[model samples]
Target: MASSRPKNAPFLFPTFNSSVLPDPSRFFSHDLLSAPLPTNSFFQNFTLKNGDQAEYFHPYIIKSSESSISISYPSLSHNSAFIYEAFNADITISGSDEPDQHSRKTHLISSFSDLGVTLDFPSSNLRFFLVRGSPFVTCSVSSGNSSIKISTIHAVLSFTGNSSSTKYTAKLNNNQTWLIYASSPINLVNDGGSSINCGGGFSGIIRIAVLPDSNPDFESILDRFSCCYPISGDADFTKPFALEYKWEK
Candidate 1:
C-alpha cells in the first residue's frame, strides 16, 4: 500500500526498514494506510520507551506484539474552560501479547488523591513511559494548593500486522466499554528519542502553563517535567488546556 505522505516538517522520520516490519499477509485485512484520519485532532506519533527511562510529561505504554493497549482521555475541546475543581482522575494503561490472560497484564489504574484526577493505565501488561509531542492539563484546587499532571499523551503508530484500524475494546471502572485508537498508517517514526514526522522535523515539545502571579515554587512543581518552555501569548496563563473529571458525585 502506498502512503500519502505529508509535507516534510523540519525534522524527518527515521529511515524505514522492511526487515523489522511484520509480514502483511499475517496481520492485515484491509489497507488502513489509506484510511482517513479524524480532522482537527492530531495523530499520536512516536516510539514507546521504558517507563523509568522516559522524561517527565512524556508518558507512554510499553509496546506488546500480542496485545494493544487502550486509553480514554477526558472529552473536552481545546477552548473548553480549564478544570478548577477538586476531583480525582484515574488512568488504566496496559499492553500484552494476550490481553485476555490475567498473567500478561502488568499495569493498573492509579489513584491520585486530593486532586480527584488520575491517569490510569493497567499495571499488568505495560509501564507508563511518557514523552514529548504531547501536552498535559493542570488545575488549581484552591489558593496555596494546586496540582499539575499529565492529562493526555499521543504517539505515531507502527506495527507488524496486515491492514487494520489498530483499535481495541476495553472496559472502564463503571464497566463501560471504550475503543482505544492507534495512529494508524504509522505516519511518524522515532529518531534520537523524539517523534519525527513527514510533515516537519523533530519537535518533541509539549505545551504547558504556569500559574499566573501566584508566587510558588515553579521549579519544584515541575521537577518531574523536562524540555518545558513558556509560549508567549495574551491569553490568561492560569488556564492552560481543557479538562473534564470522571470522579463520582
Candidate 2:
C-alpha cells in the first residue's frame, strides 16, 4: 500500500538547528544596523467603565530605552486623534519550556515593570515623551507606586483568524483578561517654533491599559475595533522558502 500523505504536506513536527535559522539582522534596514531591533507587539480594542472604547489594528514596536520602554505605533497617522492616549507599561516575562502534565500546556508568565511612554512620528520627524499619566493603562512616570502592586501573573495570547485580523490578549493567571486602549489624539503645541503639521507621514503613539478582572462586555467591545492598516497579502500564511534540514537523533 502507498502512503496517503501529500508530498507537499508540511511535516507533522518540524525541527531546525541553530545554523539553519536565518540571521535576524537581514530583516532590518541598513540605517538601523547601528540601532537595536524593535520588538513586534500587538494590541486590541478595549472598553472603559464609562462605555468608551478604543481600537487598534496594526502591530506596534516596543523598544527599550535607558529609562523606560517605548511603544510605537508605526502605522498610525501623525495626526491621529488617539496619539496621546497611548502610554507605556512595564512587561516582564518568566516561564520555562517545560509543560504541565495535568494541563498539557506550557504557560508564559507576565508581570508589570516600571514604564513610561514615547511617541515617534517618522514622517514629521518629531518625537514626544509622556511622563505624567496615560488615558488607558494604569502606570506612573516615576519609579512607579510601590503601594499598588500587581502580583506575578501568567498570560495567554489568543489568536482569532488571520494574523493581521487577530486579537492579542494577555489573560492573567487568575483567568482575568486585560486590555490596552489607545484613545483619541491630543492637540500638539509648537513649542520649538516648528510647524506641528510639517510631517504628513505616519505617526506612532504609545498608550495602553489593562482592564480589571471584574469583566466588561468584551463581545460588544471587540466588534468596535476597526482595521486601519492595509492588508497586502492573502489571508493565509506565506509559503516558506525551500530549505532542507537533516534530522539528528
Candidate 3:
C-alpha cells in the first residue's frame, strides 16, 4: 500500500534492479518550472530533531520511514550572504560563525535511529543508517531545463535476522526531480513523528524508488496512482524541516 510522501523530502531508497518502475505522470501534476522555491523574504522554520534552532529551513528529502527525517536549507534572499541572489547568478552555500549566531556548512545530515530522538541505542535493535548530511544547500534547476543532480546519496543496512555484522550499501539515483520508496509502511503524523508497521514475527528488507522528474517512466506510475488514488498537494512546495527520530526493538 502507498502512503503520503513528500516530493522534496530526503528519503531512504533502495536500488531495485527491476525493469519495472510505474510511470509517475499519473500521480503528479505540479511541474518545477511552474513552481520555484519560495522567493519571498519571510522565512519559515519547523524545529528539527537536532537541538540547533533555525528560522527558514527545508528538508528537501526525508528517508523511507514514516518518521520525519528533515533536510533543511536556509532561505533565499538578497540579504543572505551565503547565497548570491542576483539574477543569472549560480547558487552557492557557505559556513559562518561570528559568535552572535550559529552557522555551519550548508549540508545537514542525520538519521532517525541515531539522533536518540525516540529509543535509546542500547535498547533498540535498529542498525544505524549511514548517509550524507541532508539538504546540502546547493541545488537549483533552471526554469527552462527540468533536470538537475543535487548529489550522489548512499544507505547501508544489515538484515534483522543476520548474525554477521556485515552491512549492505547502495548508491541512490539522483535523476528524478522528486521520488520516495518506502520498503515498509510508515505513518507520518501531522507533527512529523512516526511509527513502523513491521509485525507478526516477519522481518525482511523492503525497497522503494523515486524515478527522476524528467524520466518518461515516472509519468506511468503517477498515472496509475491517480486512477486508483487521487494526488493532492502542490508537488513543488518545499517541506519544512521536521521532527523525527527512531528506536528499534
- lDDT (CA) for every model shown? 0.26, 0.28, 0.24
lDDT of 1 by residue, 1-249 (tens): 955666673444554446643332222113332333222211111112221111122232222222222233333234365742221222322222233444423222132222221222232222222222223322111111111112113322321222452222222333322222232321222232212222221112222222222233443344344233322112233545844322222
lDDT of 3 by residue, 46-123 (tens): 122232223322232232121112232222466545653222101111111121123221222221222111110111
- The numbered model that scores best in lDDT is 2
RMSD of each: 22.1, 21.7, 24.3
Estimate the lDDT of model 3: 0.24
Give me candidate 2's TM-score against the actual structure.
0.23
Off by over 4 Å in 1: 1-94, 104-107, 116-124, 127-134, 137-224, 227-249
Candidate 3 residues lying further than 4 Å off, grouped into runs, are: 1-80, 84-122, 133-201, 207-249
Order of all candidates by TM-score, from best down to worst? 2, 3, 1
Model 2 misplaced stretches (Cα beyond 4 Å):
1-67, 70-163, 180-207, 214-249
lDDT at residue 99 of model 1 (Cα atoms):
39
User: By descending lDDT, how would the candidates be arranged?
Assistant: 2, 1, 3
Q: Provide TM-scores for the models.
A: 0.19, 0.23, 0.20
- Candidate 3's error at 196, in angstroms? 7.2
- Backbone clashes per model, in order? 53, 12, 35
